[model samples]
Target: MTLPRFRPRGWVAATKAAQRRHQAEAAGGPRGPAPRSQRAALYVHWPYCEKRCSYCNFNKYIPRGVDEAAVRSCLVTEAQTLLRLSGVRRVESVFFGGGTPSLASPHTVAAVLEAVAQATHLPTDAEVTLEANPTSSPGTRLAAFGTAGVNRLSIGLQSLDDAELRLLGRTHSASDALRTLAEARHLFPGRVSVDLMLGLPAQQVGPWLGQLQELLRHCDDHISLYQLSLERGTALFAQVHQGALPAPDPELAAEMYQKGRAVLQEAGFRQYEVSNFARKGALSTHNWNYWQCGQYLGVGPGAHGRFLPQGTRGHTREARIQTLEPDNWMKEVKLFGHGTRKRVPLGELELLEEVLAMGLRTDLGITHQHWEEFEPQLTLWDVFGTSKEVKELLEQGLLLLDHRGLRCSWEGLAVLDSLLLTLLPQLQEAWQQRTRALVPGG
Candidate 1:
């Protein structure tokens, strides 16, 4: 498969902006949204890797002849700047996601952890995680990261078959991945999760299951299975563009999702989210905070965050995502202290659309009561003809009306796009009404 070879300029800017924000907060300015009743988690995106994965499109790059000490210092300053600007004292979870967190020096990891620990209101039981590529740092990176204060580790073992790995354009072979997983079991004292990808260019059902079976033999309680998506602008994407790499059929991908879920469920791993599975109480709090619409702060290059309103405005929320590149990021950090923040504007209708989009994907559906937050907006939508669409879906059993609110059934999940179209108009009307009534101007 051909890869995306063009340098991403937007990502570079975003990375710089994000780095600038972190730097600012570290220098004694307020960072993310203010802390309130609802606590927040922190996601530090370490945007450097040994090599860019062919299928990946995230903002990351291979480090060159750069000063490790300077970059490391910037990371510390950025973290501190965010703490001051946003006034976030406590953090529930701290996730170290990256091109390859394990590739980071152990001292760098320790410093980052220590910096976060000093931040306000960090949870005592904070779930600190680091995403590590199995091959980047040889054999004991997982143990090293664990020793550096990372309690949870996510190993990027995209596939368990050597042929599949090659097809996916991954660097580590299946055997190397297994050895890394074995090492992780002995090194990390907390829970460990393995990432697996299905729906490759030539993936088959039998071999995919074989991979899952093999992974189940060694995984530490949590596993996330993702369908291979050919996002635009990646190397794999270019290969598809040139007709060199084949795409996964949507129907086949759906079938694979079902199979993976069944196997993991049988292995005692429950599907907590669409792509996540875990044992009892093992679901990732950091990720669950997202599904539940909880708050968080994003740091480093290309990280995303959500901050909800506090006190009287507690029901409302806001969100932001950092810039994408790493070099631009370090420069910005040196200049402004933290990356720039792009606040995502949200409205009542958009919120419902978003809530439904994320909430429906999980096993636990959103409750009807939460809809009341936008209840003031839903009047005219009630008068519209589209109201019948909801009734029609209810009559057809495509959705359920239990105490957990409206949720798509297993069959309905397949036709969610169609369903959303029918509900969008009502949602839009409701949003306008709510804004007019509740917002100051209306």
Candidate 2:
């Protein structure tokens, strides 16, 4: 379940095209009206961390010493400005994510949350979540955040095995993760999720199962189990390529995925989506909104967002994307409202790609008619899929077509990407046709 080395032709082209489009858009280039949604999600990033984990590829900065006050002020400033731009006062959810959101002092976390509440009509029961790492004593801090409107916590505990943790270059020991989780469970008494990494450079199924068993003992509301993808430009990637780290065996990793799901299901934690499992009604609202193509705004250094204006079709814009460095971010925001350099329009093809890629990982299935909506209906029936492939897949228990959309059931997900690839040519050719029609005299 590592990220594929095979980038789709469309994704590569879109990546470069998007960069160009973003530059022009930033300068107020021509664009169509954007699609609308009633309630939008918000993401506030905390870039400061006590240490830089080798495997991390996110926008993170290490502070020589804690500077909770400076970080807090920046967070508040970003939130206040974003709320003013949102227009509609009501917010559905707010997720505090990044280097270590828990590093901020409880009082600091509270003030940022408070400013958000003051500027926006956050629902009385809004789902507010703060991401925490196991190294910190976040239990004592949750009460302040709760009082300030935070109701959930997403803890990053990448592994539970001492050996694996060391290999992953994490500072927290297995005991530290376990103790902190226990304390957090006791303190918050709110929804808690623990993240785990699978298929590490040196990973084994026995340890993975033991970790899952231990994780379930706390009765966490959710679990995010991700395959260790060697992201390009990350330290891990360099190690693997330089022969300092070994590749994750594919077949062994597949076996782990199968067994891991079985173990979680036996413990009553259902696999709601790929990479995420939870008790009923405990799916991450912030993340779920992403897969559903819901509108969202991201603030702070190295954050990204997707926004659909107020009333248009197939139009979404990337807002205020920033640098990954804190010093640069501070300089940028101190001058511009966050002087961002990368904010591109995510086109319909990218949107559909996101849906297809994400939906296949969930119990949710891809609709048979997705080709019609995603690409073009005229030649879709002949191009990507035949009525037979759809019928056969449904008959074989490999897919489900429902009112919501097409979904890959638990069994179908094993071959989800492969099945979609079968129809890629049809979808691509149809997309090319439409592109030509739109750009006449080509």
Candidate 3:
């Protein structure tokens, strides 16, 4: 089955006027509705990479004679600006995602962490995660990162086969990946996570399972197994479209996913999100906040964020995106104190859509409490439970809604896109009815 991909809409960088207005509002002008919660997650994006991967479509560039210090300063400044704008005083987690955050100097990481701590109350035990590429993270660098306050290391191994690694345009060999994993485990112990990709071109289920089994022995508590998605505009996409490379077999991919889940289960890992698996007490707090639709601030080029606008007067949330180009982003930050390119306030339906899109991807579906927190005006059942489609979905074993709240069943997860296509319209109609009811003379 072809699962539909849902990308959240309404992201653009902030205009100068909008930036000024946002600043003015944040400075204690007229206050609006506060966010559902004040505690938030922090995401720091690093936009530079040592080499471009064939399948990556993220906003990243191979730097040439770049000013690293200036970039680091811009990141710290942006983080401070965003923290003030968000009015979020407590941080639940901090994630350093990137073009390659592992490429950053330990001092740079420490600087950003220090700035965050100064602006907000980052708890002593908060999860501070840094994404590392096997090639960029040597043993010494990993140790330095640990010293710099990065407690969790998410290493990108991608594949364990040397041939597959080359085909994926990775600079590191299979041995390099293993070596890095070993070093990371030694340094971080139980705090290490490894990312692996399945569904590569011409990949067979047996061989893929073998690679997974091999990784299971070396990996730490968490494992993020993602199916390779050939995004449009990526080199892999171009190659497949041009018939130079064969596309991955969907049936084989599905088989790999199912079998891989079993393997992890046997190894004592629980599937938390659709793509994320972890042992007890090893779930990723940062990613969990994301799936729960909690507020987070994004800093650096092309980063995206969702938070309650400090001065907004309603339950609506703001979606923020940073400037995509590194140099331009820094320039904008220098002028406006942030590189925010656009700030879109989500409507009720949009918010509900986001809630479902993110929440349902995990085992903890949308709880009644979470729903009420997100949109206090309506309950989960009030919006979706009354629908005929929902009834059918529940009867068909594709959805579960009870005291635990609404979530997809195991069968439903495989076809989540199809399920959402059926449910989103129901959400829109429900929200519309709620709006009309709130009118004085409706």
Give me the candidate number with maximum lDDT. Answer: 3
Q: How would the candidate models be sorted by lDDT, starting from the highest? A: 3, 1, 2
All models, RMSD in angstroms:
7.9, 11.3, 9.1
Cand. 3 TM to true fold: 0.90
- Model 1 spans with C-alpha error above 4 angstroms: 1-38, 137-139, 308-318, 369-386, 413-418, 433-442
Per model, state how many residue pairs clash: 41, 7, 10
TM-scores for candidates 1 onward, in order: 0.81, 0.80, 0.90
Best by TM-score: 3
lDDT of each: 0.69, 0.68, 0.84
lDDT, model 2, position 356 = 65
Clashing pairs in 3: 12-342, 13-341, 13-342, 14-340, 14-341, 14-342, 32-312, 32-313, 33-312, 33-313
Candidate 2: clashing residue pairs, number: 7
Off by over 4 Å in 2: 1-38, 86-88, 232-245, 309-314, 366-396, 402-404, 423-442
Query: After aligning candidate 1 to the native by TM-score, how far in Å is the CA of 286 from where it should be?
Result: 0.7
- Cα shift from native, residue 224, model 2 (Å): 1.4
Worst 10 residues of 3 by lDDT: 3-12
Residue lDDT tens for model 2, 1-442 = 2111112332333344334423433555333433344357888888877777777877886656644556556767866765555553556788988877776655555565556655654555668888987776445455545544567888888888888787777879988888887876776564888898888886878878888888787756788888888888777788888999888777777888889888888878868787788886788877877766666777777888776444444554444576767777767766765535576767776666675676567675455554344445443344434456566777888776655556676777767777686445445566677778789695
Worst 10-residue lDDT window for candidate 2 reads 1-10
